[model samples]
Target: MMNSLDISEECNNAFDKILKTRRSIRFFRDEIPPKELIEDIINAGLFAPYAGLAVENKEYFRKFIVIPRNTRAMEKIVEITKNIMKVKSEAFKSEMDKNPYLKKKGAAFSKRLELFADKGVLGIGTAPYYIVIAEKRGFPPVQQQSLAHCLENMWLKATSLNLGFHLVSATAQMAEDEDFSRILGIKSGEYEINGCAIGYPKENPSESSRPETKEVINWIK
Candidate 1:
């Protein structure tokens, strides 16, 4: 017979285990997450509290285009993403050349693009599901902030569900570009500010590194 203290200790241990096992999980097993489970994660994000005001507004007026697991669709997305990264790198280099002050930052940005290029679009060739979270209206003050907050909530929910989420800022840039924008049906001009790749963890390769602590957090008594 287990007492209340023993049960509580067991629960705490289980929770710690979950946290320890949780990593970026670049690779994943080949299995599609259930539709209901995905919906549940989104719903959790939708219910997140607003910044301050009680404005009841939907994040996305249009439907989220869930790209199928087809090779053609995946290849198209990868190609688009690659081109977007190239364009951004070129633009950044051009800007740096004109402004000497921005040279250091430009070099760093170019390096990131090169590293991401090494991995390509599907993120280590493991992510099977690509969720393009797009919002309709890209204006105003409150609405924009609200939408960003919604995205943050969604990312947290994804982590809690043991799913891998990699934000391809370059993909969002592609969403805004002239040619690719048409594919997303974004009013022929609107832009997607963010994009995330979600899927189960794979096993081909494992483990990714994160930066150690910076001098950001300091507790006061």
Candidate 2:
């Protein structure tokens, strides 16, 4: 039998593998994740630490809106995202025209815009489930930080369950549009901070580049 230290090291290795394998999935199969699995992921989010002690406060409320395979709702979201992409592309093109440096560096941005147009949505994938992370407007930065932790917990949980997960930050703008906000069930004073797409991945994506620990960290004596 393995020693306790060996067991601990094995568990650590498994966690590292999960962390490394958790890529931002851009394509997913046309299938919905099990409701129980989604509930477990949400439970992970709920278990994340918060900033304040007041459980009743709006700031402490962890709000998540799940849209599971709703064709009409997805259609509306896609339409709004397409409109936003159009406006952004036009704005970027205008800026690029004035600045030669911007014109050179913005090739990748232009390509991404084209891809969004082709996909008919801002998200990286056509996931069967879309979750909107919303919070009360004008909340403190600490509250936002707490929500971020909650999201990370959910991401890890999804990865452990062999589910695809991708953060869709671009769709946050949808919360500003009255009709889109209404469709998403966002209250008048609430703001959509982030969004995520979840489903079973069609393909396993390669790992993305990252900076070395030495470059990103500082050692203090």
Candidate 1 residue spans exceeding 4 A from truth: 1-23, 49-63, 115-119, 122-126, 141-148, 203-221
Where model 2 places Cα greater than 4 Å from the true spot, the runs are 1-14, 49-60, 92-107, 114-118, 122-125, 139-147, 205-216
TM-scores for all candidates: the values are 0.68, 0.75
How many clashing pairs per prediction, in order? 5, 0
Best by TM-score: 2
Error of 1 at 3 (Å): 30
Cα RMSD for predicted model 2: 4.8
Q: Which candidate is the best by lDDT?
A: 2
Q: Which ten residues in a row are the worst by lDDT in model 2?
A: 51-60
